[model samples]
Target: MPASLSGQLVVAISSRALFDFEAENEVFEAEDDHAYMALQQQRLDEPALPGVAFSLVKKLLAFNNGGPGSGQRVEVVVLSRNDPISGMRVFRSAAHYGLGIERGVFTRGAAPWRYLRPLSAQLFLSTNEADVRSALAAGVAAARVMPLSRQASAEHPGELRIAFDGDAVLFSDEAEQVYQRDGLAAFREHESERARQPLPAGPFKPVLEALQRLQHEPGMRIRTALVTARSAPAHERAIRTLMDWRIEVDEAMFLGGLAKGEFLREFEPDFFFDDQAGHVESAAAHVPAGQVAAGIAAG
Candidate 1:
């Protein structure tokens, strides 16, 4: 029988997002695939340095180490556009880092987001904007991981904390456009008007639901936060949306356009996801950050 990913919190990640392939990626972008493939082949024996999402992935996979039957609770797979030969290095690097990642799909240069369906992945992390958008379009929770973001500290070894922006992330960017086009007063009024109506689902909603399920499992030490720029009147709709979906986060911060860096520094999340570049720029300095390149922000 085929291997099963059922009943698992499956995460589908790209090679670049898992490891520091920026140098090779530079070649791939500036020159051609042949050069990049050659470089990857040459570096097959070298283990890659951890990328932005490494700590988050490491901490998440740790949830599976409770002995024999524990592995059934979580699964992480490499879903990349790298060629099969380059994929060799990916597996080798995982082994080198003592990561138990075993499954992979190498598509050479083709788009890999399509495989998320078969893998039943609740989260898809990649450095490719197109891939992230494609996955989000397919109803998968996906984020364009910031490969240059600060790595999470080893301080919280046992707990996995993840932070998320409210608009264009857990909820649709419909409200964000209001704030961007009409300014703060209009945005607040719009959200206040629609406070009773749940906002439309965004790219990260599926991942939140998956994490909520994981939180219920025995021995799981995952904590999630909703860290947004919305406050007071605007915060109600975001809260209502989560309530409507019957999902609850461990924490929520409505910063009202304030800088999120210091607050995230205190939260110490293994990873943080935001749709706006400004928030991500601030948060990345303090915690590992990924940009959800969806909604109006990406445009």
Candidate 2:
């Protein structure tokens, strides 16, 4: 039988999203691919530092007993745009960090999101907005990782805590569309009126489902939280929606219009995902964060 990633939480991440390549990225941004490739080749033996999502990736990879794609509860693969030569450094860096990431696809400047389907990836984390948008459009949950986001806390070595936004993330942007057009009062009224009705599942719903499955694995410790800007009457619908879906969240914060950074600082999630860039930017200061880039609000 062919090796498969079935029955596992598979995450595909870009090289820059996994490791700190900002300095090298600056060189690539100068429109000098040759220089970038040469730099990577020259630094092949030097391990790159961890990036924003490093801690989260490290924790998630811990769920695997064997290695990536080895029928463990989790599988993480490098789906990068770097050339094969540059990819050597990525693998070397992973090895140096004691990360058992043995699977990768080096596309040499091409969009790697196309392979997310074949790989059965539940999530795609990349620093490129276009790549993330492409993956989201293709029915894959993708996040444009905030490169400057704070690293996750090391205190939770025995547990994995993930956070998510409500609208346009775990739930569809239907309410968000109303909020954007008719204002918050109308949005709240709409949600309150249909509090018992479940909102449709959004782009990241599949990723949440994957995590839900991982939560059930023996000896696995996974904590999920929903930190949203919805408060009071509006919050009821969101809670009811989750209840309808039978998804359990360890924590829920209905902040209304308050800034999410301070609260997230207290929670110290391994990673946080939000559909709005503003919220993501704020949360980035407190935890490893990423923007979902989904729904009407993205426009």
Candidate 3:
């Protein structure tokens, strides 16, 4: 826990991005040439990693608490090589294996190619010195090879230090849609008047519950927070929602109209997840961030 994993960079990358998932090519005599091809294909087709490691990736991504000012918090990273072709292939095939393929670099390419033009990181499973160096230069903290093999836990201070956004992230998008359709004043009035009511759950609540379980686990690491745009009279519902959930968030802030990036830099979270591009774009600069898509709401 070391008081804080901040004052340092944190990142989330894919496993294939770090290690070569495909078996190395081997040289053999011609007698079993066909067999070799089949074997290699099988390896590529089923490059199953240890389930424990896979769970670790989820655990790390699920950790929302961590900030620069907070006590020890390791920056979580998901190492992923940017192979356009292979990445494309993986996306197309992911559903066949019952894996969830949410949008992002691997799915819809959130950080468009143009945005990444400045970096020379390799496009495939090549975690070579050049790729690593380029990624660092391009602003990736510690790179993580995604898809861990087992369930794992990242230890932080007794405090879990969770952080989240307001609007669609915490409450349902009904309010946000009003804000987008109407103006700030109207949105404020609506939220202010509706302060006593409960908001519909956001996509991350179940995941938040999972984190809460981890937080309550004996000798476990957990802390929580609510970082939102709602402030003053309108923020009551948000606070009450947490209470209703029975979750103990160590630090909660209502930014009102303040920019989240600056506060996020100060917060230094282990990993921050949001559904909006603006927040994630800004927070990614200071913390390991994941953009949970809106599709999760369908569940």
Clashing pairs in 2: none
Q: Give the number of the best model, judged by lDDT.
A: 2
Count: clashes, candidate 2:
0
- What is candidate 1's lDDT per residue for 1-299, written digit by digit as tens? 98889888899999999999999999999999999999999999999999888988887787777666555677999999999999999999999999889999999989999999999999999988899989988988888888888788788777889999988888889998998899999999999999999999887887888788777665548888999989998888898899999999889999988999999999999899998888888998888887888878766
Evaluated against the true structure, the overall lDDT of model 3 is 0.47
Q: What is the number of residue pairs that collide in model 1? A: 0
Q: How accurate is candidate 1 locally (lDDT)?
A: 0.88
Candidate 3 or 2, higher TM-score:
2
Ranking by lDDT: 2, 1, 3
- Cα miss at 167, model 2 (Å)? 0.3
Q: Candidate 3, residues 1-299: lDDT per residue as tens digits? A: 43333332233344343233433223223334355445444445553432212333333433333334344222333333333444444444333333333332532223332223322212212123344334334533222222221112234433334466655555566777766778788878887887767788765565466566556333336556677776777778787777787766677888886767678667655555455656656666655544444422211
Candidate 1 segments whose C-alpha is farther than 4 A from its true place:
218-220
Give the poorly placed runs of model 3, Cα more than 4 Å off: 1-161, 295-299
| TM-score for candidate 3, residues paired by index | 0.50
| Model 1 root-mean-square deviation | 1.9
Question: What would the TM-scores of all predictions be?
Answer: 0.92, 0.96, 0.50
Top TM-score model: 2
